[model samples]
Target: MAYQLRGGGGVAPDLNPLPPEGGEQAPPPAAEVDRISSLPEKARLRILSFLPLKAAVKLGMVSNRWSHLVNTPQWPCDSILAIHIRPATQGPCGCLVPTHIRSDQIMPLLANELGRRGRGPGHRLLRFFLKVDDAQTRPADFYSLLDYAADCDVEDFYVDAGLGPPEVSFNFQRASHRLLRLVLFGVGVNQAHRRPMSQERSINTLEVITIENTSLGDLELKWVLLLCPRLRTLVLRNCRVLTCVDVTAASERLVRLTVAECPQVDKISVSAALGLHSFRYIGDLLRSVALPPTCFGDLRICFTKATLVDPIQYHNWLDALPNLSNLVNLTICSNALKIMSALRNRENFQTQVAKLSNLQNLRELRLVLYRMNTLMLSHTYGFLRMCRCSRLRNLFLELPKARTDSFVDAVNGLAEEPAMDGFESLVKVKINNFQWQCIEIELVHFLFRKARSLQKLILVAPKGTNPERDQSGNAIFPDLNLLCLEKAPANVEVQGAQLVLWL
Candidate 1:
């Protein structure tokens, strides 16, 4: 007869029978044994920590023992608790209409959750993600939540107010040392606050910090960096108020840095970062840049404008590239190509190309194109000719949406250049947003003729465009037949052409 397991509230059967009237009870039946209940409490808690907070809460319904364990102060360790405050109603158009949610309405719920955890030395939280979609969220609520997370020894803390205005100014004077990653989006920084002597501390455990869509000044940015002594990655995007980013103080441990869309940043100085391996700057070319002399493994410089109106400033930035020699991978935008092409006839154009040739170690190159025109296409070819093609192994080209039917005529009318050596080392070429237009086919043909070592060609279709079905429910491009059968070269492997559809 099966017996009920003790403390299981009649939910699970005790597989071990009273063996032969207390004559050495047989080992518990392996198939029906409760293996999870046999593990230590710490091990079980660790397994539960991998689950989401909602799933952990639902696990309490299994049995009374589980319910008690889940309700304990140390139930969850290294778990994530995400709270999103986005109250909405259905609109007439069947869309979600965001409704106003006050901070007072959310504070009580947060308090109740935090109270249940009973924060102390025993509790630990891995990540605390809080996103407020309401514009009325007060700064005090953020502070209280941060305090609660610190009390629980949270490791990763992410706060996003991007759905609303940038009104929350965080004061990091009392930041905890247990934080390993901090991400703040659409949040400002309080510049006037100073840490008191009794609470003065540094977040030495932080390894990554990302700030986006925030209004931060240079002094405040430096102040935040100074508090994190072990930061390895720092990303600043769309921070309009930052004029300069000087990471000399935090350069010792910095390995990667990215600054994107910060239009006002005039200068970026990273004095002596021996460990920096990757650096990406995406915006207008900076007026001043001071980087380490070490060879970078990856580098990206993407200009937002098609052409900078000022010729001198444009040439000055191009002249600065030779100093960053020996990059393994490089990504540039069509704008840089356009600017460089305009100087094709000038004497310094060759000089610029020669300087760029200093990057003999470069292997991969990515070109982000905004439009497909004859001028830009010619510039792209010229830019490739400048690089050491024998060493380049990968080529990535991002194409914009096709708008005009004149592109085919433009490609046909383009002048032919003298035959040159092909890309002997190119192993892969990827084209994103591929439209099976005449110009795209012509580009593929050009690559087929030039890249002698080409092994794989990746053609990614435009978003939501299916290669399997057409608008009328007809089979379209069965097995990507267009490229493999008609366009691909005979010598090159046509089966290597891959079609990717982005849903």
Candidate 2:
């Protein structure tokens, strides 16, 4: 048949076909097996070390060689444990898996993996990270794992309990002396363990601590500060029970402190501490604050409440300004401005200007303007006149999207008003949410004419609109330079959207 089909597309005869008679065949030798498996056990473990915990666990099932390498009686790798726990999503059918099963899957897998590996005597642990979802059933096995990590003296401990009411408390009483940082979310200190542990040892090794969305009262916070003598950074966010923050002890070592959204915090007192470099607060105005005389290089104070019925009540609030003199950068929100406006109107504006004159070292000033139903032009100009920064180089003006035409006119009037000293030192100005209105154009013209030393003008238009082209597809504010070409310096540059204009 092969000879008859020679004229057509002929099939090539197999030269190495199986023998005609059934014959036994020998398997390939072991030497020709996978090269990776042939590598040294340490080299294989090194490769597995880079894989995530999930993948590393999955690797044990690959082959006998890999199984023995990773799942032996005692792992030969260095002591490093990293655990990431999150809620298991539903399967493709959209059926929710039982929380017990989800916990069973992760907890035992980790415990077993670490059981043999961490059994070695004098094992040096590196880090421990536990990020768990707010599932109702937080298994006892999970706490056991945390206890194990704590016992092992893990260096870095981070726990984020996602968006749930606090059901569990973490006892750091026996926390490792080697722990350098502790960040907790939705987890509070165990009150039962606080008294005994607070008496026994202090967390002198800790350098940073952050707590958020947890119920921590003044006593608990003060206890933490007293414990962590070397703490350099402390961040408290939306903590419900933190009514008062008095940082006299930690003030010496703390370089940065941020308290945000803690509305109940009625008072903050930080005595003379030269090491403090930055302090940021975002909530209701504190009843009182006493900052260090040395001053913070960067200070940010925001008020949660928007309205101020009586401007005269802002006297005490304005008194907080001069406490910090050497400001490299300062950010004041609408609340501060409102109070400042009240102060300006109350005392002929000179006292308010003098209060801000202490900011001789100010380099950058950022002001946020929001729904001001009764804001006056004099109030705006008064604040500007107070910023007599010899080194003032940058100014950022941010206006809310809901700003009215009257506000724009007020700003224009403020810019038109003369100052004792013009913005000679000002080199750059950034206007955020630029409306490109007639009043805004006039204000730009005024700034260009007065700020002789101004080098760049940056206009950040509102988002969702083409910066280069407006909603109608026309060039955005085509006459930006034309409006001030005569008064603007020849070297001045106007930058808006993606377009740049030069006079």
Candidate 3:
């Protein structure tokens, strides 16, 4: 957290007062205008600090002395560098008119001031927040200004711009060593820059990077992998257009990678990402890439739409995970389950589970029933019950968004798993949006009869239901003393279950 900002919209309240030169409160005796104009140079700098990054730098025009101080060399390691266009000056309402400056004049002026200070230290956070409201906001203008920051070694660069000429790129001479979180909007990576991108550079200190709402036309993603060797987390959301992507040798040192909402990335090329710890992807795994992945930590995939999936066809992915034994927690969502559904028989299902069954260390199993329709939820739950995960101690069931249902049938299916004779290690169960039909009640009762070590049962119930109704003698689970009903109304009558557990 480079620096905390006040007010949510990236600007402080009391816009007219003019910020002091630093971060502190000024005394009242100084009076308004007197305090602002008469304050010591450093004090004025403190006041200016309160102004948003844009307004603060603009203060150079207020006075020659102000510009001198604004140009002072210091490591601005935590300033959000906003580049959104607005009228030359703010309006009367104190709210800036959303209108952007048309000419490319502001960049040269602003860049001259900051660059005159000349490549000081890397600002721990430099956000280039641009709003693409018109065709006039050239990508070159934005890129040149960002080029200045990349030269200065900005750590966090967020670019929300428009699609300009296809021939565009930022060739950082030394490669940004501190660049961490990089977000883009309405831009594309040209093929011309692909090779230089693959050329190894020193992005040794980078972390989380995201590319959003844009098209990565011919951008070789491998550059991000090879060049940014220390990167641990990445996200590319809504980048709807991409043709070729090769990320084979790119996985040197990454812990988390998230690729959601990117409709066009045709294929994912990876041989074995040795250090990859977690992965979240929505697109199909292109046959070009070997599977039975080597990612030893966690894998999460979100396939919101229905698609044909065959996990066994890519058995190489499963086999590639030499350390599948090290793979502990597995969350299979829409796309993943779709692939698993392609299996023809229990033998195939057992083969799939067998790869991970050696993970005796596995403890938590989360099943997201594409709870779209009642039938879908039933089938999902039925498919899950077929697997024998003796080590599972916790289970989570998620419902599809908007396809609302209190899935009592699915809950019953879980309790019906024939293996429920007595799970010695099993202790807890959590159901999100839990609806209690007789199936749910019987499931609860069944847990009491089966899980000898069972201790907690959590349910999310409908709003306004009095939990006191659940304390009846008819309720089972004499051992079920801890009932955590999250986000319902205030709970009462936990006494009977407690008394029974003690008895």
In lDDT terms, which candidate is top? 1
Task: Write the residue-wise lDDT of candidate 2 on 223-330 in tens digits.
Answer: 778777898989999999889888877877889888899978988776545688888888876678766666678988777677777756556555555455677988
- Candidates sorted by TM-score, best first: 1, 2, 3
- Give me candidate 1's TM-score against the actual structure: 0.73
Q: How do the residues 409-494 of candidate 1 rate in per-residue lDDT, one tens digit apiece? A: 66566634324443777778889777655556557768767777778887876545554553346554454444441244554553
| Best candidate, TM-score | 1
| TM-score of candidate 3 to 2 decimals | 0.59
Lowest lDDT 10-mer window, candidate 3?
494-503
lDDT of 1: 0.70
Error of 3 at 438 (Å): 6.5
Cα RMSD, each candidate: 10.5, 16.8, 13.4
Mark the 10 consecutive residues where model 1 has the least summed lDDT. Answer: 90-99
lDDT of 1 at 197: 31
Question: lDDT per model, in order?
Answer: 0.70, 0.65, 0.53
**What lDDT tens digits, residue by residue, belong to model 3 across residues 119-153?**
54533334434554444545667566666667666
